[model samples]
Target: MPRRSEAKSGAGSAVRFFVYRSPMKKPNTSPAKATGRCALEWIRPEIRALRAYHVPEGQDLVKLDAMENPYPWPEGLVEKWLDTLRESAINRYPEPSPEALKGLLRKTMRIPDGMGVLLGNGSDELIQLIAMSMQGSRRDKPRVILAPEPTFVMYRLIAMACGLEFVGAPLRAADFSLDGGTVLDAIEKHQPAVVFLAYPNNPTGNLFDTELLLAILAQAPGLVVIDEAYTPFAQTSRMEWLRDWPNLIILRTLSKLGFAGLRLGFAVGHPEWMEEMNKLRLPYNINTLTQASLSLALDHFSVFEEQITRIRQDREKLFRALSAREGVTAWPSRANFILFRPAGKSADAIHAGLREQGVLIKNLHGNHPLLENCLRVTVGTPEENQAFLEALGIVGVK
Candidate 1:
């Protein structure tokens, strides 16, 4: 490239133009041109080996796959919520402790006085936070995270992501209940730093034997988390047990309680553990909008209570309908969903058939050996539940 000469306005003038030639070839900065192993190499080997969690698309379907409340807020309640949101100061960050919201949750969830509550973007983030907290400065030995097998996938996934070992004890094959002996044995062997118990567990949707859980809690080496995400339908919670078991922490989410879109979850436990977790939490983790919306919703908590009551009723009705169907065995559920197996038909095909018929339910066929041929459907509104049943019938599941 040619350089342009600077024009001299006076006797002496400074040069005003400069030029440089382009490189003969562009530097090979593109990942494809460099070694095959690139930016991913910087990621922890555990994370690199992991597969991203998958959420199937559910557009224009009955949408019963995820265990979300099927009913939307009543129109009047929604207007009130919008009005509350209008007052939220998005320009300012939310309170670090979110004392007002936490107080409401503490009272609503019946968290014992003197207990501490730490909020998260959702229960998913709380799980990750717990995993991170378990990973102390001692990176020499891998910490173990234990949970009953086929319970919740995040317990294992988050553990691995945090470079901790995840140990899953298999539940009794007969009824998807915890095998206390096996779990205790595994606890002794693994000496895990954390144990996750999904109360009224997912996929299977049955509450584990309370005695077995108490046994596990007694023997656990470190913290024990009782995830009560579905407690609204189950009508049970362990939040009040914090005084009895210092090692116990209760995880609850407003997600299943019909605030899923707001993505608010709270972890209630002794302050010792809560303080440690707060250290690792990023500032403003829960945004101002979420805080304001949650405050308004908590004010009208009765609305969600009504919805949950209806879901519990629908759960029983759906269970009965499933049990009455031929070639189908539906498990009893305390949560807002049912797990059932279809005889003389492929669960995968049945799931697809349901999809084809414009209904969506979870197919747990290959997720775990215990979950083989099992499908879970969230209890929806009466019409939606009826539509799902009709689709299930069309799939030859009857």
Candidate 2:
């Protein structure tokens, strides 16, 4: 140990700062002796009980596991985009409130007038913010996040991460449609702080009835989030209904529309609610590059619109093909993917067989009891879908 020395600018005519000029000792780099410290012991048990979200490797495969736009940017779009990025202020922080980009989104997504939009790094971050905003808001009871079972997993995962109670009401076993009575009952019981319903629901690929959703919205005691991540393919929205439901907000993302890399997701709702969410949002959460790139892409929004149109057509064709197959039963979908079950094979066997044939898709056999023996495939380019259909036949799923 050594005492500090004084350092002054220009030989001590100024107020000086105290500085330590003592000889420095080499720090110990040896391995620590065990003191019985365990990170799991310190971490929240809810978190400890959860598994990290896993994305299966689809490298060098016709990746249809995740519903992504199968086409790359049209010719010359990439060059035009690079020129725009070159002009962005990379050294400066992005807008704390990105008004121009929000304007572009409002126009592009047809966001209703007078509604406020809050952007997030992605849909997951937006969900986290929604959960955090309601966390600990109730003093007498545990705050809850609710959704239908066999829908999106993030609603529950995010709820757990935020220390809120998660409740999932089951969908009907016959088709993945929401049982309004069951959901209404769950909402009445849980009185969730937020209820997340994925329009054109995930994995199962069927949209819940509109009346059922409105009924749930009417019964819900707190905020309702309609996640329209697949709206481009679904071609329907609840955004217009925002004028009617004060407790409602809708979530949309550019991921399925071919900007997944940019990681932008926005929520449109009343200013009162948006103001509270904006408080928890990290400054510059949407980076300069993302904001610029998405704004420019919206200018060429027609390119995605065309691709979406083609994908919608391909979805029906794929659905018909799966339906025509002798051993498979495919559910109808408003989204760009189809969920089907194979009569003579297990989902694991079929999924692996597709992978071996250089194709990839989701296998949801054990994710829930209702999803048993079920598999989901995204509508891809003609060649990719053909490859998958062929793979399915080869694997005896036909």
Candidate 3:
């Protein structure tokens, strides 16, 4: 009964409704989808399940966990460093061998004669290079690395990254001292290929017995890495002993010597061993700017010496202050930081209280078996140290 125009209009309306029901879209099959599928199937097993290391955030607060030097270079010396950088050829790649920096380091650091120098972005990179060189070359033997627990974590982490087995021996709980007898026993059992000993241990801030360290060096079947990152504060070194022990590699850094921003660290060891390690080193690990700046800083070593002296003095003051406090057990420290256990109060609560007061220190509770209820405070300037002591009083025994 409808006219032809009305019927045609009804058909057009039906077609519009069908089009609206199914909205159009581009194809869902994309390059990103294919790439994601490939990644899930082809990623290495070790990396897929890996957990990254946790470094504390909050640098605006008192940063004591990383053990960085709190002082900056004096203004005049900094000006001199700037002048040197102005002349640097930054557009050109840094020297492959970093000869000028090495020469200055050798003279300034008083590196032992005949020992070769190997530079790293930080000591962390050097550790990786050592592990890779050892593992890559010696595939037949079961590659083993040993480190005393409560020492540096990087040694074990690096070894694991290289797919080498890591053995961790425990320190004596009575004083956190090295148990030479136990270490020797472990060496015999495992016949480890690399051993790491942090001279002034972190989170504890106490130096191990040197006599025992020497004893371990004598018996170990493979390379021994002595991490002396805090050597500037301690002022005692075994660099002279490099002449006698070819297996020894002494690691030092400017991080604690007022140049942490530069991230410069080096290893001194027998030339033959370092030669092999150097072959595996990346060509331009040290940047041009860093090399230039470090060379200038080394030329003015007296500034660094003065700053280190102040830190050492401050450390003693902090130690005495911590010892005099009621119920706190502070251990003797040769490094620029002190480690103590809070008495009658929970370390976690004390750490939180300090955080609220805008003063942050390390809380070592449950980090290791021996470090329970312990906290580490880096020796800041006199004013900072006083402020920290005052903050402790506010949070007392609560």
Candidate 4:
């Protein structure tokens, strides 16, 4: 007994329902309209042109690409660490200022009294913090970040992220070493707001000349950040230079000290610079668990020291083994890793062949002009090192 209009409307409802029920049906559309949108549309254009940092996947394999310590903490020490963490109040927020961790770090690191320590999730975060603090109020001047190529990629990545200009000077080709004159020239030309020099440069695995570093630090117009992530292996640090150059900041981490899982890195510098960086740092940036675990681990430094010593010894053995082999040129390294070039054969072939054999190492063939046909290997346990050496023998450079 429905009226004709009601019947028509019911039919329309049924049609709509049918359309909804049909998975293949497309929505009806009106003419495309350019409506109100964010004024920051240009941000997308900028981002699209930027290359993101690619972290390698090596968790399942031998897991050596990241230069992490290949050993775990002593079982007893680990248990004690866990017991210490048992009382942590994870339900509540951690202290905004991790004073205890800082104190422990100062004591453990033997940090100078006037210097301040800033903790980072990793040294990467500290790099970002340095960039943020230096960039400050100037979007127009185009803050400059100066670093040598074939070094840490984060310096350039972070600079690009902050919309700052990055100037990468190539390392000396013969040895992949820092060229002080060239670096000083770049500093003079660019007037960079920040300069980063990775002590014991990555991928090349050689420490920069100390005298040259001091000269560059003296000449640099802006802050000089010396990333000493591999200091444990080298057993040398510029920490004492804090008083000599207020513009100097030294970065260190537990990653190479057998606690990559904890993700603890610290930057040591004058308190004034640290104060500015602290202001921009997120409250409770480091979680309670990490701080507690790192504190416990620091208390037992001998355990970590023994592991590092073993790695250094293993590194020497690996270097000697590679050097004796034909068709591969091994570079000297102060780090727990080695960088070598395949003399007659393509590094790619060796890398792929090793991977096929269940061995993994970084193939740095085309990354840079200096790194052509280069492969970097982390120093592993005696057994692991022997395995890698045997794999190399099978692949045999040429």
Candidate 5:
């Protein structure tokens, strides 16, 4: 692609010049003349076969689908945060490896000594980093990425996007629990380069067994990433395990802690792994505004801590309420949300009714066999929870 511009040396005279030009090669526009010719033919077959992950529009609804904390900073803290941001230098680039932010994260996240931290815009980017780094030198035996089915979808998506094989071991359908024997068998068979386990697994709202995790960790031949995105709600962490397991990495994010807008996530692991992942990170991925905002927010961590406590309490209340409903079976949750299956009604129709009543939530009716009729709702404030419950009642969901 090239651009043509005109420059006038004098008042009347006009001159034409190629002011701008693209240095890289442009896409091939020639017609293939095949049985069915198209631009998609240029794309890799694996990429062309992928379906994008979709997020529904939550423009005017109560917006309880994304598992976001539905709270804002206190009045006094908001003013202080604005003041802190006023001091940030937008004209200058941020430090490539933000030492100060890393220090705060280490202290705030309780990372153990000798462990290293690498930041990402979010856990999604960190997953991309890990996938990219695992593209082994040998192509004969392509690298494999493994995880339990019905967990976080990104683990498999990223692997496929990176042209690596993905193997998903199915979780027990009875209660969505990890089957140790099956997972171990898959591990032995696949020899994956990376394995992801989402603690307090999403859409299921229960943690995997600690003993099973340890057994898998010991038997695995490669890195095991324990995604703790909801650690704030769970009130427990595996940060200390980095010192014990060289192949383990703990991935966390502040999105669930009321900072989803800032999109900050960190990976704590052995320096050897961190150093390599750091190499794949783009320069200054953490912007000035995010760094400034996070620093200010950490100064008032107690506010967020209080909010987490309230959410946990609200979660218990919501769980009890849902369980008491005539035809709803709610699963126990340690995270800030609950997953339930509708006993007699269609999950899809109920989800639509909630939307029509100005409440939005995730409907997992057909996502997986284990989640046949499941719906997840984030624990919101007391009023929001009441509104959701009332909407449920209005829909005649006994």
Candidate 6:
């Protein structure tokens, strides 16, 4: 496709130029329209086949689908935060390096000494940066990204978006723990450029075994990323592992810590790796508002930490409730969400029934073979949790 731009010469005469990029076939249709034949010619079939990541509409619903913190700031804290935002300079671009925020995050997250920080709009962006940094990034022989099946969807989505092949090493069928044998075998065969292990992985909500993870680090031939997005609930971290493994990087996000609106996530690792990934990060990628809000929020970290403690307690209670229910097989979780399966009911039917009763949660049927009949609900306020439990009982659960 050709992009038109105007430039000025030394004499100030206007100059027009057309830049043509490859991978796009010229279309017979004119540039006036962007659909129909034009889209067919320019869009990759791989992209066309992919479904855009969708967030289900939850207007007027109880809303527990996404793994997000359910509580808001206290009224007094809200006022103080508003003041911070009001004083922030939105007119100027944010610090591209975000040195102060990095220092604060290091203290808050307890990242090991000597590791550097690389910030992202969210962990999703950092994941993309890692994928883009792989050798032959823009498709010479398509680099490969490997991860255990039924983990976070972004690793696969970002890999394909960067013109790389994604390989899923199957997880243990009974539980969603890492299948060590299969993973090691796949790593040897694929020689993936990036291997992602989501600690307390998504959808299944179980932490992979530490011993198996270390084994993977030993066997993997390329970069190894530990995605600890749920560390706020799990209360364990692999930060110390970075001191030992040169190829290791740990990814975290404030989204799970009652600050999802800020859109801040970061990577902690050896300086050599962060220096390379930093090159692909867009200039001023994080806006001033986010930087200001996160700084203020971190100072009031105890407020969120208290909320996390309550959520952790409630998560156990909710787990017990699901486990005691006759038809539900609830898996224990170290994340804010619980994964369960219905014994004698259709997962879709149960999900739809809950929505009709003004409750919204994830329905994981058919997403992967291991996730069949599974649904995930985030731990909410006590009242909301009761609403979900009663709603589940009203649905097909015995």
Among these predictions, the greatest lDDT belongs to: 6
What TM-score does prediction 3 earn?
0.87
The alpha-carbon RMSD values of the candidates against the true structure, listed in the order shown, are 5.5, 6.5, 9.4, 8.0, 8.6, 8.3
Kindly give the stretch of ten consecutive residues in candidate 2 with the minimal lDDT sum. Answer: 31-40
What root-mean-square deviation over C-alphas does model 5 reach? 8.6
**Candidate 6, residues 1-398: lDDT per residue as tens digits?**
67899999999999999988778676666555657666788889899889899889988999899888999999998899899889988888889988999889989888888998999999999999999998474245677899999989999998998888999998987877887889999999888888999988997888999999999999888999999999889999898999999999999999999988889999999999999999999999999999988998898899999999999999999999999999788888999999999898899999999999999999989888889899999999999999999998899685
Give the C-alpha lDDT of model 4.
0.84
> Candidate 6: deviation at residue 14, Å?
38
**Candidate 4 similarity to native, TM-score:** 0.87
Candidate 3 achieves a global lDDT of 0.84
**TM-scores for every predicted model:** 0.91, 0.90, 0.87, 0.87, 0.90, 0.91
Count of clashes in candidate 1: 0
| Whole-model lDDT per candidate | 0.88, 0.90, 0.84, 0.84, 0.90, 0.91
- The superposed Cα distance between candidate 3 and the true structure at residue 250, in angstroms, equals 0.8
For residues 108-166, could you state the per-residue lDDT of candidate 2 as single tens digits? 99999999999998898999999999998466767999999899889999998988998
Error of 3 at 244 (Å): 1.2
Number of clashes found in candidate 4? 0
Write out the backbone clash pairs for model 3.
Answer: none
Model 4, position 374: C-alpha lDDT score: 88
> lDDT, candidate 4, residue 387?
80
Clashing pairs in 4: none
Q: Tens digits of per-residue lDDT for model 3 on 1-398?
A: 22233223644653222222345677779889889988898876665665577777866786665677788778898788889889999989998888788999889889977889999998888888889977843457558999888777788778877888888889888678888888889999888889888888775677888888888899898999898988888888888989999999999888878777888889999999889999888889999988888888888888889888988998899899999999989988888888899889999999999888778888878777888888988888888888789889899931
Candidate 1's displacement at residue 319, Å, is: 0.4
Residue 123 lDDT (model 1): 93
Q: How close is candidate 6 to the true structure, as a TM-score?
A: 0.91
Question: Model 5 segments beyond 4 Å from truth?
Answer: 1-38, 137-139
